[model samples]
Target: MQKEIMSNTLKILCADMVQKANSGHPGAPMGLSDIAVVLSHHLHLNPQDSSWLNRDRLVFSGGHCSALVYSLLHLWGFDVSLEDLKQFRQLGSKTPGHPEFGHTHGVEITTGPLGQGVANAVGFAMASKYAQRILGENVISHFVYCLCGDGDLEEGISYEACSLAGHHQLSNLILIYDSNKITIEGGTEIALSENIARRFEAQGFDVFECDGHNFDSIDLAIKSAKESCKPALIIAHTVIGKNAVGVEGSHKTHGAPLGAEVVAASKEFMGFEKDQAFVIAQEVKSAFEASIAKGMSECEKWKKSLSQEVQSKIAELQNPDFSQVQYPAFKQGDKVATRVSNGEILNAIARSYSGLVGGSADLGPSNNTLLKNEGDFPKGRNLHFGVREHAMGAICNGIANYGLFLPYCATFFVFSDYMAPSVRVASIMKTQVMYVWTHDSIGVGEDGATHQPIEQLSHFRAMPNLLVFRPADANENIACMQVALEMKAPSAFVLSRQNLEVLSPVSKDQVQKGAYVILESENPDVILLATGSEVNLALKGAEMLKNQGKSVRVVSMPCMELFSQQDQAYQDSILSNRNKTIAIEASRGMEWYRYAKVVIGMDSFGASGKGDDLFVFFKISVEEIVKKAQEI
Candidate 1:
């Protein structure tokens, strides 16, 4: 009886909110209310302490149904208020069109794009497993629950992440699928045909089904899923726009509001006052309060019994000892690839800091991202993400948000496109999910244009708050990493495939400044700017120019995003007189125009030849830089 009232109250509140906003998705909220009732009984969350480490992680993969999210949060004793519900979809409101993690008190991970949330949940499950191994079962034990819809299951990332979850045998992960069979265009039959249950079973998930509108059946399904030894999926067959008077089972209510009259009728049908908006009866609030009380009790018990070992583990991860870190030193003039140095530096950091864990997307051998002797995930530091680049990014974002560990993922530089969406979200959330992208240019020999990343450097550098680092040599790579370690935001470490001669030991200040004079000449005829491998090229070109009696100042701009943030005075000091400055990189280099006038860069696609030959053929060589500098 209490479940019925609560579900109906949520339904009415959701319908009225969309009606008021005249924008936002109403159907999903209406469809999933019944499941929410069962979920409330089982999910462990403390509104008073939303960041409770041992609390069950709930991810709304179908984040469009934010009306339902706020309604549940308000009833379950979260800070979300009745006024927030009334302000749904409004600018500057707590109830935005989609749930944002830090923006909303109870949101675990910012989820909007369909399938990424499922991957995020898997990541949480993985994090829980790792935390459990470190802090012990007494300290970290939590199930990760994700509420997803048909649209989410249809996305390719779902398959990639789910497959990895199955491979890892993450029994604490449960996915609740709202099988509403509706899309923006109409019924899902228009695009989907495969049996979802069979697919999940094939991916090693224990599957269950329930009547979405039946409270007992939904409860039973969730209970059974929790008991499963494998990652579980509970398919709830639901009616889209469940209680809307006219569109109850239709897709018309998917992305838009139900009309005022229809909402009123739906409310009345659900035993609510026809005109009442954001309705939550005292009895329903009390019932949700009971659930909150139970959760708080569990939270208190967990907090009171904090073991000394648990405290130490948590403290270690929360505040990693950066000073204890022994950074590998590269000898000046030693030919070492940035990727190789990055691997050594990564291992060096992991050896001291147990809080850092990550892996490459099947490029461990080539990318040099393998954490040696750090076994497999959930037990060791190395996480084998296989070839799932998109899921790898999203999962790393999840791990970063899990609060105990810093996460990183690696892949060939060009394939950053596969996971670009997740990277954007990481930037938005300011998740410290480092991207170690190697084979940074036309230097990916024989693999051809498909493997080379030309525009990727500029493309990511343009993204707000995402620091893109292209270290000139091994020592600069260390400097870039030094800056990356202290940042709370996402960063991309772009490493070269070929060896670059170490020029000098770079100071953290130099890398933090994003650009510094690597080689300087008095009253320069031309100021040459470059990044990554091009810095060495620029230096070589500058030496040729010096032999010909032309003065030059060569600058290594490792990170453009950081460089742009510097004061105009500092920027002028590095890029003095734009007309006399030439930016050289193997990639597009279009963004360099902000600091340099003449740019020596690749305008055409690279070919399948030796990396050095391809560089000269593509006119990104010493000769090209000198010619462009001379022309300037």
Candidate 2:
């Protein structure tokens, strides 16, 4: 009876809040409230200590139900309060339209993008499994639960992430699908027709079905899912809006507030005071607080059970010593692909940093991201993310948010388009994730225009908090990783497919400054600025210009984001912002306008040919740079 009342309490609060905001989704919260009540009993979490490592993770893939999220966070004894709930959907409020990880006290990650939370759940599960392998079951044992709706499952990324989750047999993962059979466009029958149970079953999940509002059935399904030997999916059948006068079970309630009169009617129907808003009966509060206390007790018991080795392991993950990493050395003039160099640097870091773990999207051979002799995830360092690029990026973001792993995902530079949404989310969350994007331009060679990246470099560089590195050579690639790994944000290492000449060693400290003069000329008549493969071309161009009595300053701008952060004085020291400044790169180079007066960039798509032939055809060669410099 208390569970029933608590479910209604949550529903009423959700309805009240949405009605007050006049612009929030109330349907999902109302529909999922019963399941949320049942889940509260099984979920292990301490609001008193939200960072408890052994606590089960809960992800709401349908973030539109944020009213439910804030209510749960408040009722479960987290820092969220009734006032915070009142401020729902307001700017500067803890309860934003979508739950933000750093902004909200209990949000595990930023979710709003459909299907990302499903993938994040897989990532959390995978991270826990791997941590358990390292610290033993007693120190690292936890389950991951994800509540997702039709929109989440309908997105392609969900399929990609779920496929990988099943392939990995992540037994600790449980995905609770809120099978409401409704979307914003009306009934899901208007679009989706797949048998979701069969799809999950085919993907190797242990599938269960339950009446969402039936407490006993929901509890039974959850208990059964917990016992499964593989990742589990429980489809909870529900209505879009379970209880609202005139609006019940209709898609109209999906993204709008339940009318005040209707909310009053619904509350009265549930045996609550029709006029009261945000009322949690003392009995319901006690039940929820008791659950939190139980979770705190479990957290304490787990803390006491932690062995010394496990504690040390946990500490290592929390405070990684980047200084301990032994970077690989490269000699000047040595020919090596930035991809190969980054692979060596990655292995070097993996040998020292146990938290450094990731893999490529079925492009390990090309991306060169395989950790040497370190085995596979749950026991080893490599995490084979399959060909699911979209899932790969989101999963890596999840691992980063899991609080121990410094995750990375790799693919051909051009394929990043398929995964840009995840990468964008990672940047927004500021997850310490690395991206190894090889074949960094038309340099992908014979793959043709379809496979070559033209604008990826500038597009990503434009993203906030994401350090996009277009390394000039093997040494620069090493420096980029060294710098990227030390920072607490997402980064992408745009590496070369073709071997580049290793320039004279640049200190990691210098690389941290973002851009510097790689080759200096006394009283330079022109500044030749380039990145990645074009830096070497700039050097040869500078030499030719010198022979032609034109003094040149060749600068390698590896990371424009970092450079932008530098003070104007430091920026002016390298760039000087002169009319003769020429920026050259194999990509679109849109952001170069800030530093260069003349930009020589890819204006059109590339075609199938050898990488060198493609460079020549695209005029991304030393001759082109020289011509541009002379004009400047």
lDDT of 2 by residue, 152-215 (tens): 9999999999998898899999999999888988899999999999999999899999999899
- What TM-score fits each model? 0.99, 0.98
lDDT of every predicted structure (CA atoms): 0.90, 0.90
Q: What's the count of clashing pairs in each model shown?
A: 0, 0
Instruction: Write model 1 residue lDDT over 83-192, tens digit each, in one string.
Output: 99999989999889889978878988888999999999999999999999988887877789999998889999999999999888899999999998889998899999
- lDDT measured at residue 619 in model 1 versus the true structure, 0 to 100: 88
Error of 1 at 134 (Å): 1.4
lDDT of 1: 0.90
